[model samples]
Target: MHVQKHFGKQGILLVNLGTPDEPTPRAVNRYLGEFLTDPRVIDNLPGPAQQLLVRGIIAPIRSGIVNPFKPGGSTKLYQELWTENGSPLKYYGEILTEAVAKEMGDDFIVRLAMRYQNPSIADALKELMDAEVSSITIFPLFPQYASATTGSVHQEVMRLLSKEQIIPNVNMVNSYYEHPDLIRVFADNARDLGPMDQWDHIIFSYHGLPQRQLKKGDRSGCHCYADGTNACCSSISRVNQFCYSAQCHATTRAIVAELGLSEGSYTTSFQSRLGFDDWAKPYTIDVLEDLAKNKGAKKLLCFSPAFVADCLETTIEIGLEYQEEFEEWGGEHIQLVPSLNGDPRWIAAVVEMLREEVGSNVVL
Candidate 1:
């Protein structure tokens, strides 16, 4: 039994997509397997079929997929990811939590947990429950609400609580993509890059999804169109209406307005395609290549807004693969503007997210 001690209040859990215990093939395989096999994470797809596709196919494909993006592949990319502390996500989570604690100052217990692998959700929740917290606010760190990402976290938390002997009052912060503070963070990133004048195009690349899964996500039965809507590619209820794309566009618009960039100077695309099914539209790689081939666009500035912290997808895939591909297509100077990992403004945003959701007195 989780021995109850002095009763306090609820806690805040900043849940993120976790990293493997180590950066190795075995661990990565296991982590990838857990992440890919989730029906909700992959969404709209039925069981055994998904497994046959992921486990049977994607499993063997991992080595090949990750090879070109690994640290061995790009030293500059790896350097950008490195900090004196550890993995960028883990480090930034700690930093944001600490900053949040600074802002909140111990009124509420603030903690961080990954959806899978080290600092597991169970461990974080157990700690909170041990403290006899009255409630919990879950901030899954995906800006866009996708069934696969935020929905996955929600279900995982519920699943964990269902198995628990005691439950705490919990409020989930589903999406803050439209939150002004978050917009400020993105704006800061864009401004930090100086003028948007040098770049030929601004592409906001999001994590891709199978188009069939996205279509089936239309719970409202009216989300099949391409326009950015909450009903697009999610269970269009009160919950996942604000997913990655909707938020991505909102951020893009916010940044564009902030920078006063021209109408056609910026665009959005999806990256990191896994299987051969229809995912989100206007794939990033295809867009990059086309921009180079036709528009004669050379210099580019790419952003992965779905991720607040740098990771393999952003660092390796986009910073390396996408950059290389751009250069291959005669495009030059592909600069992957770094994410707002622990940026003072981003730290402020995280703090604000906690304070607004839970209260001002929560632990940072």
Candidate 2:
């Protein structure tokens, strides 16, 4: 048996969607290699088959290493997103973790980890385990629950804990889609962009997942309507609770209500689809195109509620790339509301979540 040392009574592990350590092609390749290889992420085939596809096809195409078609494609994206504080995603996560740790005080030791990169989940758990924590609470940064993101984090946590004979009492925050505090933060961010009426249209663009993933998550089979309307995915109830698309819609509704936005003032779409075996309908690009071409909307405001912190997807994909596309389509301006990355409100929300989970007896 391993030596047991009393380090802390409780440990908090904050998990975020990973980012590359640096903006180099090698770093991007390494990060993507690990992230895309996960079964929960790809999910199209069996383990060996997935690995073959990832190592052979996806990784090469993304990193632009093997083939001559697009060298440093991902690397270029990373370059544009690089900040003085390093990757904005990781930097914000570190700040948020520190803020939460301070809020939690001495009782709970907080650690930050990326699901796919440096300060990995495996290493973070080991640190907590070494501390001999009686209980461990895992709070994934994903506000909305998805198998590929939150589910993958849970799976990895369990996989690591399985090796330890003395497993700590584990608790995971599955999703906080309608958390009032979270909704307030998002609404507040939108308000910071000045007036809602000043913008022609608001787009709540969330990360896309294959339709198959949605089907797999559908326990009721009746949930996840193909039309992408409020009738099915609007409410947060037991039947369609685990549905990511439904949860995304729920988040949009909550924020819009918080911001006093009326129906038809905003629209929801999915972004970042890969391979495209029919992802969540009405892609963000398509939505932007329609708004500019048919609707004659000039200025657009976008919100990516799927991410709590700004990453390449937010900073580059929506902020830079989407702006360029919209401009090409005769749109004058495209603004992305900043993510709740270490914002005072967001920090308070996280602290509140931890307190609620840990209980008053824990002495936080």
Top candidate on TM-score is 2
Instruction: For model 1, give the 10-residue run with minimal summed lDDT.
Output: 70-79
Report the lDDT of model 1 for residue 52.
84
What is the C-alpha lDDT profile of model 1 across 94-187, one tens digit per residue? 8887877677776678888888777888898888888888888898988877777788899999998998787876788778766788777776
Taking all chains together, each candidate's TM-score versus the true structure is: 0.85, 0.93
Runs with alpha carbons beyond 4 Å of true place in candidate 2: 1-7, 67-71, 226-231, 360-364
The local distance difference test score of model 1 is 0.74
* Weakest 10 consecutive residues of candidate 2 by summed lDDT: 1-10
Candidate 1 deviant stretches above 4 angstroms:
1-7, 44-57, 60-84, 226-240, 359-364
* Error in Å for residue 18 of model 1: 1.3
* Residue-wise C-alpha lDDT for candidate 2, range 1-364, written one tens digit per residue: 3333435678999999898898776678888889988888888789988888877777777777674345568877887888899998889899999999998988788999999998899989988988888889999999889999999999999999999988877888899988999999888988987989999999999999898898788787666664654356767778878889889999998999899898898999999988849888779999999999999999988999999988888988998889999999999888899899879899999999888887732431
